[model samples]
Target: MSLLKEKILQVASDLFQTRGINSTGVDTIVAVAGTTKMTLYKHFHSKEGLIIEVLNEHYRHFHAWLSERLDRKKPAERLQKLFDFIEEWVSSPDFHGMAFLKASAEFPDASSPIHELSNTHSQQFRRYLAELAADAGIADAEGLALQLSLLIEGAMQAEQIKRGSGAIVYAKKAANILIKSSLR
Candidate 1:
């Protein structure tokens, strides 16, 4: 990303995450980015366009972070690392539910670019989960991975609603149980 685009993404991601996609205006992003209106419009056709890009950036960064931590780990550790990662994310000061979830909820229709990008990121997560589960030798790995993915998503939402990270404990426990059962 260019310096300007990076700045714009940072400012817009913060604003959109904190304020919301529909509530946040392009001017707010441009002003925060310290750039001109033309520059903003030049890069993104409109606020919706920018919002989609911001969501994509979030997914890209998130996947990068996960890959960095997970790609080098042994199979068992990688599975646990997945749990740990979500736990930490839920407890982070910046926790604001799942960004993709929130964005898709704001615009349920799949036609919106933001909604589409959110779905794409979500599918990527599932694919990663499947790979991890298979690598761990879990029985019916693909199906089990989907279940685990849904469980993690649920845990995140529960933690967000409860305003604490404790809900992740259940997810961890559930994953352990699933692994054991699959082995049997």
Candidate 2:
């Protein structure tokens, strides 16, 4: 990516994550990025285009972070590691729920690109969980993955609503029960 484009994306991602998609305008993005609207348009074509790129960037960063944390763990431990990471994440001061979930809420129209991208991001994460479950020798990996995915989503919402309470701790306990039951 071009240096200017990268800067724009970083600035936009920070603003969008902190503020929101609809609340942060192009003018603010340009101003913070130290680039003009014309330059942003030249690089991204439009604000929606920029938003899509920002979403993509967010997914990339999220996936990289998750992978780095879980890759070294054994297949059976991966799920636990995932929940551990989430627990720490929700406890952190910077926690603000899932960015994709926030984006989906902002763009409720199912046909919208932002909405579709957010859905794709979620499905991809679920697929990853399913793969891990299968590798761990679970018989119903798909079902287990779906259940775990629900727990993760529920924890995110609960944390958001409760402002980073013990939702993840409970979620992790539920996940452990699910994993034990599934293995049996």
Candidate 2: pairs in clash: none
lDDT of 2 by residue, 1-184 (tens): 8999999999998898788889999999999999899999989988999999988887788788878888889877887688998787677777777889899999999999999999999999899999989988889999999999999989998888778468888889999999989998
Kindly give the stretch of ten consecutive residues in candidate 2 with the minimal lDDT sum.
Answer: 88-97
For each candidate, C-alpha RMSD in Å?
Answer: 1.6, 1.4
Candidate number achieving the greatest TM-score relative to the actual structure = 2
State TM-scores per candidate. 0.92, 0.93
**lDDT per prediction?**
0.83, 0.88
List of clashing residue pairs for candidate 1: none
- Cα lDDT tens digits, model 1, 1-184, are 6899889988989987778778988888888889988998888898788887888788787778777888889986677678888787678888777789889889999897777878888898999998888888777878888889888889877876778758898889998888778767
Q: After superposition, how far is residue 6 of candidate 2 from its true place, in Å?
A: 1.3
Q: Which candidate number would show the highest lDDT if scored against the true structure?
A: 2
- What are the runs in model 1 whose C-alpha is more than 4 Å off? none
